[model samples]
Target: MMKTKKLIIVGASGFAEIAHEYFDADTEYEVVAYAVEEEFLKTDTLNGLPVVAFETMHQRFAPQEHSVFVAATYTQLNRLRARLAAASKEKGYALASYISPRAFIWRNVELGEHCFIFEDNTVQPFVKVGNNVVMWSGNHIGHHSKIKDNCFISSHVVISGFCDIGENSFLGVNCTIINNIEIAKDNWIGPAVTITHNTDVAAFFKPAKHEPASVNTYRFLRIKEE
Candidate 1:
């Protein structure tokens, strides 16, 4: 909150483009450039910002002067973001967090470094968040929700009150978590999963069904381990 901050978006993606709107609308940070990996550097301008080589963008604007944020959306994309953060640090540039102005976050809602929160996210009171949490648009994080570190929550997720989301968990689009639920670490909650209770640690819940006569692998796969 000292000088006006400048940002370099790390991906030339639709998600990145959408994030630009939130950044522009909410924060005082000005996105002066867009950055991509050497291979994905297509056009020069994204959202009217110059496209710079992510590999060396920090040379022009030192991390002390400017900050960077990742904008990828894939489940595995967070690893790459972590790498980018390391790379940026090597260049002496710090990673940044973008919290939307339109989002309703109550006081004492803890946020860690490098968290990206988009518009329309209603984060209630007593919510605890850890580092590297990417919460996309339109999420309702109910009160007393505890989100562990390195969680990726896609758009429109409804996490009810007292939900405990574990570390490295990936909650896909439109996922719903009922109250008092404790999702264990490393669980992949596939899109539209309405979780009502505690899930086993390291579980993968994908909505699967049978085409008639074919074994319902989803149902069959639910049997307890021998």
Candidate 2:
């Protein structure tokens, strides 16, 4: 078999570890090292690879030889990840995309550069996923949905058909967006929130807290004392 491209993950966090595992097992990119900011650089190695400083990573791992993947989470509404991805491109390194083999992507789906789609993501036909987008596992993206750039979708998000998710938006886990809804840019959707209609710019929707139970589970279940 031919040799695969070398990859350098620009993070050492939990998300980076997941990224490494997926890319190493499924993709043609071999993860050779990890890169982080100088101040945040704690250890010399991660996962048996050297943890290089992001400031001078290009010197050690040349852009022409190794590609980069910014394995940042949804920090600062994905602005930090977006910035790092852009910076890697500016440094002349190609950005790598990770699409899990377990994902079910329709042939008509259009995915832009630097995207990360985890396992069990069902992307329907005509779904347009923009650049620098990250979708966690088990998301059901319906047909004709348009997810714009720099969006971070958590696991189990159900986006119905004809929905448009705007840029720099963060969708938390277990959220559902109904059909034909247009989510605006910079929106922060908390877990379990359902969107049935269009939203304004920078909309923030969080689920309401439920009242605590008056009695314990044993009393509720009416179990006899042992």
Candidate 3:
């Protein structure tokens, strides 16, 4: 039988716990430890494993024997995740990728290292997902779409065919990128918004504010009195 590769997750927060669960359950990676910055190190243990300072984690867990996954969210515009991913590579640790079994990824699709593709994601043919990209559950990535590195796609998003999402972009939940659209780098697309064409670099797009309905649900139902 093939032995599973030991891994150290680069975080200790809730997202790191989720990454640990996914990598443990679906992949061949055995999470051995958690690593965070010295200043952020509050606890000594997480998920029953020793939490070490990232500065000296390499000394404890040799990179030649262990792999790493930066289990960080899209905070700081994904710049922090990108920086950590690069640092892990520099430390001679091979980055890991996790694709959920419930996700439908085509055979021809290309996924880069350190990617996290969650359940119910329908990644069609000819799709290329770059490194450090996070696709939350239930996103539809149409054919010929290319998601660049450090991009975070939220749940229920629809990226139609021939779309190109640039690096460090964040697409919020329920957003739709129409066919032939190219979202530029560092763009932040808010929830429920639709992009029909190309977007400028570092642009922030959000849906219009929604007002409360004048009639409540109880009033609209009009119940008959006895």
Candidate 4:
């Protein structure tokens, strides 16, 4: 397929590379270049594409012709991505969203710009996904659930119906949010956590650290410790 719409990804990190791969393979947007802040600009090319300075990228790829996608992770509680996205828009670049063809999105689901929904994600009816939201693969966003702006939802999360995930929150991999739960803004729910009740603003929920057995595994299994 001929990809007519040009796209510039903001960032040169691993996540940015992944975003390039996804957009190139699945979407109509042809990722032409990668952009980063001048202070952090290192390589001239990433994934065979030119790595340009974000400050002056618009000069080469005019915002009127090219769109941008900020491929930042949950750094600084998603503030970095949000800031870059806002800056890109201020530069007159239209924010591009990528919804995987493999993902199942109900007709009533409302997805905002700059959002990235990966494969195997099931966004049911009445789900409202806000801008700059990143939903990794294999998540189930139930009916009437609202994932606010700038949130990063890791893989295999199960958000039940009527849940309200607040803005700038990071839902870790394998986390489960029960029905009717409201996760407050800036909350960090760590891996394997199960949230059953409403969370306060800026709440941090992490799974208990694993305690290894006192006996060595080699000794227990009667094997040599190499």
Candidate 5:
């Protein structure tokens, strides 16, 4: 049996905690510690492991012996995760990727490092997912699709075949992108929005909020008020 590799997660947020659970239970990586910026290092322990300061983490866990995964969300349009992953690489730590065992990834899919693919994600054939990308649960990445680096795809997103999602883009929950569409870099597509054509760089698309009806629930249902 292959020995499980020791890993250090870079972040102290909820995402880091989730990454710990997934890495510990599903992947071959054994999460040994959590690292955060010194200012945010409030507690010394998280999930029964040492929470070290990111600035001096190398002193404790040598980069040659441990790998790192930046467990950050789509903060600053994924710039934070990208920066931390780059920093971890600069510190001589190999970036770790986590593809859930429950995800259905095709044999020809080309996935890059530092990517976190959650459960129920279906990555079709010939898909190329770049580094520092995060795909949340239940996302469908169609055949021949290319997700560029630093992209964040939220839950239940659908990207049809031959789509090219550019770098640093964030696809919100339940958003749909049609086939052959090219989503430009740094785009922010809001939840439930459907894109039929290519997007410009840094484009922001949001669905209109549903307005509440003037009639109360009791009146709309013809029921007596409590």
Candidate 6:
């Protein structure tokens, strides 16, 4: 078994609070501190752990003896985490990765640091996921797919085999990317949109909306919304 460390989590509030639960359940981390971006901190002791000053956390808990994880969510999860990661790396602290015990990952998969893979996600063989990525619930990451750094993927999204998603993209819920396609950088694919071919860089796609047909002559109270 891997030994536990006296840990500190950056981004002490909001979704970081929610992520604390998973670490709390695992024996691999003996969480000892929480730190934020200075402006949002309020006297420490998040979930009973001391909220240490960000700048002095290393002095108090040296990096060689302890490690840090950035727990911020996807709204600004990538950018903020990347910033703090640079800070920690300079101070000799290692960025942590968390894969939920309930997630299913095949052999030969490569995941970079600071990734959070939540429950019910299937990462197939020969897949590669880059740094600071967040894979939410029930995602299907097909064989040989590559998701670049800093991407946010919502629940139930299907990334088919051999597909490549560029860096910093946002994939909405129920999004489907067809096999062998490439979704370019900074793209925003809306929920339930099926991507069938290679998308241009910075492409934005939205679900198609249809107007309701004329009301049925016999239907009185069940008309569509205005």
TM-score order, best first, reads: 2, 5, 3, 4, 6, 1
What lDDT tens digits, residue by residue, belong to model 6 across residues 98-176?
7988999997999998888888999999999998898889999999999999888989999999999998788999999
For residues 35-94, write the lDDT of model 5, one tens digit per residue: 999988899998899999998999999999999999999999999999989998989999
The TM-score, computed over Cα atoms with residue i paired to residue i, of candidate 3 is 0.96
- The 0-to-1 C-alpha lDDT of every candidate, in the order given, reads 0.83, 0.94, 0.93, 0.96, 0.95, 0.83
Provide the TM-score for each candidate, comma-separated: 0.82, 0.97, 0.96, 0.95, 0.97, 0.86
Q: Which residue pairs come into collision in candidate 4?
A: none
Task: Kindly report which residue pairs in candidate 3 clash with one another.
Answer: none
The deviation in Å at residue 79 for candidate 5 is 0.6
Off by over 4 Å in 3: 1-3, 223-226
Root-mean-square deviation of candidate 2: 1.2
* lDDT computed for candidate 3: 0.93
Better of 1 and 6 by TM-score: 6
Which prediction has more favorable TM-score, 5 or 6? 5
Q: Compose the digit string of candidate 2's lDDT tens values, residues 1-226.
A: 2338999999999999999998888888899999999999999998899999999999999999999999998899899999999999999999999998899999999999999999999999999999999999999999999999999999999999999999999999999999999999999999999998899999999886889799877788998766
Clashes of each: 1, 0, 0, 0, 0, 0
> Which structure among the candidates has the greatest lDDT?
4
- Would you give me the overall lDDT of model 5? 0.95
User: Clashing pairs in model 5?
Assistant: none
